[model samples]
Target: MKHVPAMQSLTPAVDARYQTLLRKLITKNGIGGKDSTAFVDDAKKQKLKTDESSIPLPVFEKGIHVNQAPPTSSNGLNGNSPTDDSTSDLSKTVSSTQDDRANDVKDEIMRNVLTIPMLKYDDLKAATDNWSDANLLGRGGFGQVFKGVWLNSLVAIKRLRDTDARNRELIRELCLNQYRHDNILPLYGYSFGGAEACLVYQFMACGSLEQKLRSKSHYPPLTWSQRYRIAHGVARGLQYLHTMTGTPLIHGDIKPANILLDQCLMPKIGDFGLARKGPYGEERTHLKVSRVHGTRPYLPDEYLRSRCLSPAVDVFSYGVVMVEIASCLPPIDRNRPVPLLSDWIQQQARDGLDFASLEDRLLQGTPHSNPGLCREFVAIGVHCTKYSRGDRPTMLEVYKRLDNLEFPGKHYM
Candidate 1:
């Protein structure tokens, strides 16, 4: 409940200095285009060294990747070639060696995938009441979600349509297993039968932030205070995902629907099916992807145009979500001049639009009415959704700003 002064209301000189500090941090952390090639080259050099060290010993036998000095005339190596039988045997040996290496790699990956508990398919089915419609929570393109009770605790079972996506499901589970944060949705277990795969997660009573924000009649419209809390929690979660993980992760799809609210209304970021590892080194700016897989409105222009993904994509999506939290407007609102919520918010911020004009109507007369905080929060979102990916602030910067906001409730770091 500490009250900190808003940066947006400060003098122009102070604001400039603040922005300069953010830029310095971004450059120091190698989050921009500068020096990216150097980082990549250094990483490639290190990888080459590792590869050379791990290279198998040269096979001296004939026709099997032999690396020997040219044979002398006394040895008759120049004129004589290996017999057909010897050649066939060498080829088979090489093929067998490759198969063994491939299997070893596959086994290692499977071991990592099995870090989480694997529940029996029958138990999951029983918990969901044999997949009854009454226990069904929702459905998506990949699968359906069902509410269930397992081991005397509530859980959500995401049952896939078929076994085709089992590999993807396991990959997601592996990613979730490595992530442990209060703002991250916890994975309970998974079940893979011969026909289908199911991923179990901790159940959230309130459902998604999208449902609460969009479906006002079914669920009470979130107050301004609640929205602020959700925004801060999500920012902290994204920051953790970007930096705290051994390797940074990009949550490709970061819309409101992917953000779940627990019983106490704490926000937890979920849905890792589209999540991908970021660049290898701290100095690398971005990673190029062959294809993009995220909602269009939440994607930045750089990613959509070049398919080069970075942590900026998530920042852009979070900005759009922030605008929604502030205005209660959908991402695609044809009624607005800009149409796109992120773009509209960015425009408003650029024009120094008053927070009052963009504030959610329901916030009026509420105890959460703090004009300075609202303006600063919206400004942070605008900074995040900059048109140029490099121009967007890092999640750490966003989190620090949110952490400084003054509010009545106890803050969770």
Candidate 2:
């Protein structure tokens, strides 16, 4: 059989590793044996199924924006409490149907993961001290992460909750192993069956960008320079996802919580649970979804209204994250004069407030703070958050603008 060409633009070592992986995959597909020439053509045509059942496409009630929206009635309207036994029985039936669907998706994921390297469930459990609370790293919509030691190396083990979201994340993360970059979080391995489904990832000593932004003394405050680098790193990672991959991928969720930082504060984008592959070829600009599924303030107007997704959706979310980094404020805080931080920032900027007046209070008087750089940075974010999808800059443009920002003696770029 003919060999697949090694991917271009990768280092020799990375390309060699990819070739090794390709050969192993060919063998696993039963295409490495003699008389396997015919099988190669068929394998090349195989692609991931993108249907609702196969892709974990979420089904949300008509007006729901967030994943944790309140329950709606049978007729798809907000209804008062049911006062009859029949209503209770109906709820049970709906729950059963959801459970069956979740199991089917989980089964498909368990089968797909067979091709990857796996760790023993018991060994992972032991590494985390039987999943003790003390070892907990953080929690997300899909699972709880714990810090652990595996093969004498520090790792983060994520024990997923038994739900459709978990299945979706598991499959997406599996796909990430093939598209490695310096800014993307690396997957070490996975463990499944027995008691829980777990994915092991390279440990981030500095935790998530969200944690650092919201820190109230548990961790040191992030200097202006660190925030600048964090934004640049995240932009590079998102740009890679959009244009570098063979098929452009949209990281549907790009909140600060998904961006992790290493000990030196180098940022790596993580959590592909909500990621979706964008349409292929230049003619196709967007992918239509059954319903909108993402966090608020980060989602763009077009995505929410039309359910049409493109790389711009990710760009919009990244813009919101930029605002977060500059302001050191949560995306949504009901107590604030403006509940949505992105909107508030835009309003304040439009009101002609200087960067010094708009920046995080803690950043004021700090030696690293530079009003000129901060203004330029916030302007980039505002440009990305434009109401019109066509108006926002591509991630590449965003990266270039960030790269041009003056940060003296910074070598990471």
Candidate 3:
């Protein structure tokens, strides 16, 4: 791996370049990632396959949404004249509009009181053979996800250890119907009052990204194209969580283990057990806590110290994940002296270490690839993991720049 310059080597030119890059991508007018139709189109064009027995993506109303202000032109909905009966008609219209809004609010409340699909303990026992180790797919912080057949199709059942503490996640999942994005994993339902309190989801054909990265021998090393695509997908998912959705979600846990893969090798952000409804208006999002939930390396310093939870923590974790993906290495290897991929990469970059060699090291035998693109991505990761949350770019901005990145032979201006 290439070592960038240490902090001491950050010359004026390097700082200027970095600042210039950020300014170029982040326009002052508005957010950068609002228009990403091109990138979504490119992902659709990718024709990668994975090892699965005829897998299919669940259709969950992942439709296009556009949020715009009400029109202000005369003779429009707001236009009104007040003469004789005109005033009476306008009052009636306003009253009806208010009534309609009240009804919509009532409907929203009913939606939150959703009727979750319940499953009996007997059914889960039958499917998992009484929670047999043979059926266990993997374990999580608060539960273990078991692979089992449900209603003639495969499903992942996460058996929660603490139902009282973790039930909120299931509620959040249901509420995120307004927050649903294609790259986000869908929650099928939940089963409480059963022997095992659990949440159900569509089984990811290729499993978690962590599995693929670790078991390179079993699964081939992901090509640069694949990694790039995965990065973009993950970013869009985060963007949806941060901005696109009505209720902003702080995923709390953002790591490769939470990122699952589908039949086409596409990425899906999963595991909302630690998710929380983000702050709004003047509301403070920071939480005072004695305990923090997350992987050690991925947790930012602020999160550990003040327990001030924010979307920036997820962004920081994403930065670490980015480093891992680019270098095709784990966050930390105990056996190796220099552990924690993001720190090492950042230290190298700060020290003016030659980043040129990162491509050959990370990309391996891929003779046809884009090193410039890889370097730029690494830079983004470093910025995300910055010590100050104020410095990190919003998830939308991250997606915008990433989408604009050109592939090997292509040129864009």
- Which candidate leads in TM-score? 2
- Tens digits of per-residue lDDT for model 3, 1-413: 01011111111111121222223333443323544233233334544221110011101111111121112221211123223353344334433433333334324323533544556667876777778899899886667889888888888888877543444444445445555678999877666546556678888999888887777768877777778878989999998887764445678789999999988778999977667644433344443222356677887777665455567888998988887777666788776566777667777778886554565353555675566766777788888888788888888889998888877633311
Candidates 1 and 2, the one with greater TM-score: 2
Winner on lDDT between 1 and 2 is 2
TM-score for candidate 3, residues paired by index:
0.67
lDDT of 1 by residue, 1-413 (tens): 00011111111112121233333444465553544434334333442111100212111112232122221221111123233453345445544544444433333333444466767889998999999999999998678999999999999998877543434544455545767899999888776542467788999999999998888879766766688779989999999989984457788899999999999899999887777766545456675443457787888876765555678999999998987887777899889899888888877776878965666666666775655666766777788889988798999999998877776553532
Instruction: Show where candidate 2 strays beyond 4 Å.
Output: 1-53, 56-115, 411-413
**Model-by-model lDDT, in order?**
0.67, 0.69, 0.61
Worst 10 residues of 3 by lDDT: 51-60
The weakest ten consecutive residues by lDDT in model 1 span 1-10
What would the per-residue lDDT of candidate 2 be over residues 173-254, giving only the tens digit for each residue?
A: 7756766888999988877643767899999999899889887579766777788889999999999988985457787889
Candidate 1 achieves a global lDDT of 0.67
